[model samples]
Target: MQSSLPPPSRGRGRATRERSTVPRSVSAHQEAVRSLLQAPLSAAGPAAELPLARARGLVLARDVTAPVSLPPFANSQMDGFAVRSADLAAGRPLPVAEPVPAGADPGPLRPGWAAPVMTGAKMPAGADAVVPVERADPPRFPDASAAAEVLLPQTAPGTYVREPGSDIAAGARALPAGTVLGPAQLGLLAALGLTTAPVRDAPAPRVLLVATGDEVVAPGTALPEGKIFDANGTILHAALAEAGVEVVDGGLVPDDPGVLRQLIREYAPSVDLVLTTGGVSMGAYEVVRQAMADQPVDFLSVAMQPGGPQGIGTVDGTAFLGFPGNPVSALVSFEMFLRPALSELRGLPQPRPVVRARLAERTDSPPNKHQVRRGVYAEGTVRLVGGPGSHLVSALAASNALVHIPEGRGAVEAGEDVTAWLL
Candidate 1:
């Protein structure tokens, strides 16, 4: 039976321990997780004035108006002679003015004379066109102070001249609030003479990560007869890092609840959230559930395959999230829940790109649960990688997309369209 939960949360909200064992819907659990994190995230805050180098991936806090137009003044786009287009009509040599190197204020052009302009040099006022040096007589700039003359070809006005505000006008919006800073956006700011931008570089929650279960052994060590390498810690750590969260590796904790409690009690003060992988399923040695029995966080059975079992709540004032022992389930949990919360709170433009694609193979899913299947998304189609099992790490590795099979969808046809999230 489904639990009759409230729209927001139930009870003192603090005392919202599991009142029923019935599974919650995937979206319901996602909202629960987000509601739990909203406060600390707000406490962590936003709105920082960061330099251009550090503002990438952050959202603009306010509209950035251009201080000066792009290419504030007219400039040459080539190493050529800046001349009055009318003066060059005769194709005759004219007295060469001072050489205008980049960054120099050469001066206004005198009628009937040409100014030797290097690339990006300010075009002398009154000069309307540029004739590439190769097209001029002798094809070389005359020595400064040498009383030289040069020839130029007739060219239309504005040739090779980058006019002011051609890219963006002065006092116009360069970027609007909520625009994520990227290379192109940052470059535009630099061109606008801005050294820094006011951005919403909200604090990335500091997570204390622990890998649980006696069956988990650190990588590079002996894999005993019954033990496997710990892929969860590495996977979760890498994912959290990519999302910009500061991760503190808490290493492995055995199935013993005392050790788990001690580790959390000690590190709870230093971290904004506590994350653990394994021991959340319905097994005899479910250490995470055993340890969090008294905490206000709820141990939920979400209506989702693979990652159905979840533990989310607070432990000693530190937010907590628990994922199943299976590698695939753990990652799916991160993708479906934690990643979205972090991205929303951090103000990222898009946490992940979701697309609709045609399925390349037939599949079956439970009608009551949402299913996430690993697939290879290409050319608007998604092909399943392996059997829909939670332990298929090899198949997960070979996949680049997560095909989302929504609740109530079952027995999907080969050519049916499905929603996919690009990794």
Candidate 2:
């Protein structure tokens, strides 16, 4: 959703529009968005001690030290006979003392006696090695009362033994603060015998997502003449949900200012943020500007391509942000200005992996505006996806990275390095 006041259209698009003043830099507007999110994020409250099941996808609030060593005691790594290296003299037959099942502790191994231990069973005292059940002569464990003698091959010390603290030592920092707990990370905690973890408690904030404009209609419906299916709503809803937001979809709002205002009024009080796409530019039918004329919304032009028209401030006492109506523009606006801010507030879904890659082909960009071109970054190079048109929604879908062409760089040659945010 591109506003009427868009950046200079590069690569097969229209010429640049004249502006009243130099637009704000992308970094400057990013700082502004950060400031905007602080209020809602702070209201989310403090740290929480959560069970492992509920801690996944949440950032760790504090470092977790191992309370107990992994493999706390010496345990058998295989089903074997617990034997002392000194006991295996010339492969002599030794009487089987007893069988140790998984949990029961076999007291110390008697001298010249063999104890059959199951896998994961704790080893007995005075036993420095183990001979597997297959290798021991007779190859089977007899009853504890039956007198069955076994012969064990000569083996090295600590054979088939799981030494204490081999995986991780006690009191060691297993996971540090700010680590996002996933299944693997939680498994590590479980291995350390922890039932719970301390994580940064971030509430799922409610967001009112508004998709405006008369030309836009919901998907699955036949588009009338001069109308298209709404992409902004779907795009924004998925992005919000990915960041762990409780999205209240406002549906398709026509170009009527009254209708949009009523929708905002109905949902704004219940939500932490009011996010809208479409109708923010200075065009004649800019319904967002029309609706928020009396409200405290600062509609301004940002120095960024695909999405340039920006609006930030409050509407009816609710924090708000308005993006352009073009589908690609809306997505770019989110990735650039909104996503990072939300991630900072509630660390979920993780941040975009950023990398520097060489350009796969020569490309042109606007003189002073920041540009985000959808690209396919493979190996060590990135190739542009589509021309620099905000309306190229299909092209955006095919991209795996957003190649960032910073302000002041005009024409870039092949092999030149550029920053790309992996999608």
Candidate 3:
């Protein structure tokens, strides 16, 4: 007999939140990406003989304990006479006995006499105070060692002596785990006498990039009618590279489902993610969407102009994200989705810092879709690089930011506040 449960409970209605069917804008897409990537990732494992030189930008996997106390000894902090403060009177110069230099542990302080000490020298036993060398007149040189008798003024205990464990106590933690190895952290660890550190391995995700279109040709190649040089490939490639991703760079794939499917199947296992451009929309010759039909693909018409079409899914445990064919759209999709996703999985602070700027002039756009208009932000103002068209390469070349204008908004007047994502 099959195990059967009782009837449903009345409170089950509260178990699930109502799903909103409203089209998600570009901001919403970015928010979804931000939320989905909030899960923690595995950190690097510990190892002996770790090469710190090769661990730049890696997070520490374990705490670094101090093997020895900082300063490691009670030493002199200044070149002065080491003396017992008890010997100091209201008005008097103490007699100088032995001279102590750095690196040599001076024996116990000679009774009734002060010792001339150099900076970093271990304080003689029972030494209470240090009279700076300059403070002594004629400089005190004990019998036969030097001529002038050094006269030191009365001094106080604990003066000019570096106490043991003053910098860091022995067995103290030098640096905590999960610290991104920076110059300061490295220096601190070195100061703690750590020649090696345990750091997490940086998981560099292998990615396959495919730019698809019959009209897209390689740059510097002869252009035929109705064909343009591919810009999305280079743009997305650079973005992925900066984010520490390894790209296969499959280049352009003609609008052929057979080739696309074969490429997807062949490259999926080797790469952690497959990124494709174009051929996912409602266009008649859309090959990527057709080819991916056999796989788990989520076709989304995100409420964003220029880059509203997108596809995301998993094929045999390898993820695939399909972006629009336009250069600006592809880049915006990366900035909105993949960048933040990878940053989360890779344990970065934040993908990129977004700034707010004003439009330098008036511009009109669709009210239903959030538009990503390319522009240059300068002098506390943002000037549109060109018209709000995604195919304008010249405009994109001049742009350093993508200004996000929200949906249900039409013409943006000059000097209006707009959220800008830096490129």
What is the lDDT for 357 in model 2? 95
Q: Write the per-residue lDDT of candidate 3 for residues 53-89, one digit (tens) a residue.
A: 7666666777888898988888888887888877777
My TM-score estimates for the predictions, one after another, are 0.84, 0.81, 0.65
Put down candidate 2 lDDT per residue, 320-381, tens digits, no spaces.
89999999999999988788778776644446888889999999999898889999999989
Q: Which parts of model 1 are misplaced by more than 4 Å? A: 1-22, 44-60, 86-97, 111-114, 133-156, 179-188, 199-203, 360-362, 378-383, 411-416
lDDT of 2: 0.85
Off by over 4 Å in 2: 1-20, 78-101, 109-118, 126-161, 200-202, 347-350, 378-381
RMSD of each: 4.5, 6.3, 9.2
Candidate 3 global CA lDDT score: 0.75
Models ranked on TM-score: 1, 2, 3
Candidate number with greatest lDDT: 1
Per-residue lDDT value at 365 in model 1: 96
Better of 2 and 3 by lDDT: 2
How much is the lDDT of residue 22 in candidate 3? Answer: 57
Q: TM-score of model 2 relative to the true fold?
A: 0.81
